[model samples]
Target: MMALYNGDEKDIREFFRVYCNFFKEQGYDVVTFEACIGMIMPGAGALGDSRVIPVIQEEDDFRNYPWDDIPELYFKEYSKYFRALREEMPEGMKAIGGVGNGIFECVQDLTSFQGLCYIAADDEELYHNLFKK
Candidate 1:
């Protein structure tokens, strides 16, 4: 099995390295898709401007940060970035896309972890709603 990401190469490689190292510690050899395609910096989005307070840094440094306060352009640019990444994936490899068991992490990134746990426990409908969104 191989894992690939659409973000910074260092973070992606670190994730894969830790993933493989954990499995290898128990005896297994794995090849990551990033390793298959020699990457160094990868790509990142610039969804900040004067109107927006550069929520990316806040989102990265803080949890349960209010993203609803961000401008719609930020989300629009981010969605465009994601769409571009989706389009860039090899057609044969589309079916393999996902964070494996990290669905909750994806949700947290989309929403927030504190909100996610509440939705997971108190509002299944809203949880799935945000998840599909």
Candidate 2:
């Protein structure tokens, strides 16, 4: 899956062309594609379960985190893949995908699952606010 994110425009196009064919061979008219948003997060590897430390451990950590730039970061990192999928899809086939993980997963990626649970128990507001953001 990470392979789809590398290379220049021509490489991306070739990747998607082959990907779309793979789905077709499986007797499907649609292909699934998703960009991992967690990769764009400030400190991320937890999403891939690398056991790295969490980025948000306390209120100050959350406050200092760059909450506003995720979208741009995502586009910068993955928009080309989406464009390639669009341009390379076979005429009768379509692709369905968006960001790889949902809010809960993203939160857990930022704060370890245990840490999030602790926050929920100790700082209910912050726990809820994490989801709100």
Candidate 3:
């Protein structure tokens, strides 16, 4: 399985081409393409800055976070790559959808692993609300 981060359509297509070819050369019969739905909160990997590590500084930050206001560009770019990949998919290959971070995982991303434990104990309501969002 290979996961692709956000990029222009051209770059994404080129990557798929190379990726499929490499696997074919290695005698693999199938390839999986993975892409994420944009997350509401930031984290250490993929969606957030690697240098900064954790994007959310505090638990309170989650209270008023914009859960549904993802920018148009995210979906636009994602659709572009998704369509391209499907159109360019090689014969006998299968495509798989990538589910981004789940409720628990997103919370861990917003708060660190340690912080999540603290929040879960400190406010059960807030923890549940996180999942509700």
Candidate 4:
């Protein structure tokens, strides 16, 4: 995942410039630059080294997810970043929308893989509602 360290447009631009230049210098033909806002989750836990534990442990937590309330603001911020990234894209490089995990994948990320399966089978309403959000 790409992160804007300073959350500044200039830094964002410079990041892409340096990234694309590095690839160009390596003689690789880069064609597209993709961006995404990433998944929204309550919190995360670190497992031994490279794994994470999702913070949403129960149905109530999923139902009360804060992102459900102010998605418009999130989209607005995402658009601003998209526009800035697009402007900084290397000439001739096409801008592509990054792939986002689907609802099922999101549920798995918010909860655990086993928890997601159990919830979907045991509480159909909650399962559907989680995705609706």
RMSD of each: 12.7, 1.7, 4.5, 4.4
lDDT of model 4 at position 86: 63
1-133: candidate 4 lDDT, tens digit per residue: 3576455777776776776677667766553444322343445222111257655656787756677544564465565556665666667665554534455665566666766677788888777776777
Off-target runs (Cα >4 Å) in candidate 3 are: 1-8, 22-30, 37-60, 71-74
- Writing each residue's lDDT as its tens digit, candidate 2 over 1-133 gives 7666568899899998898989989999899999878878988655457478889888888899999999999999888889888988888988888898899889989988888889999998889889999
Looking at model 4, residue 79 earns an lDDT score of 59
Candidate 1 segments exceeding 4 Å error: 1-30, 34-101, 131-133
Q: Which stretches of candidate 4 lie over 4 Å from their true place?
A: 1-8, 20-40, 44-58, 69-81, 90-93
TM-score of 1: 0.27
Q: Among these predicted structures, which one has the highest lDDT? A: 2
Q: Candidates sorted by TM-score, descending order?
A: 2, 3, 4, 1
Q: Tell me the TM-score of each prediction against the true structure.
A: 0.27, 0.89, 0.64, 0.59
lDDT of 2: 0.86
lDDT of 3 by residue, 2-115 (tens): 345545668778877887777667877776655444342334342243344444444566655665554454465466666776766778876665445565665566656665
How does each model score on lDDT? 0.39, 0.86, 0.60, 0.58
Model 4 steric clash total: 0
Q: Which is the better candidate, 1 or 4, if ranked by lDDT?
A: 4
Say which prediction, candidate 2 or candidate 3, comes out ahead on lDDT.
Answer: 2
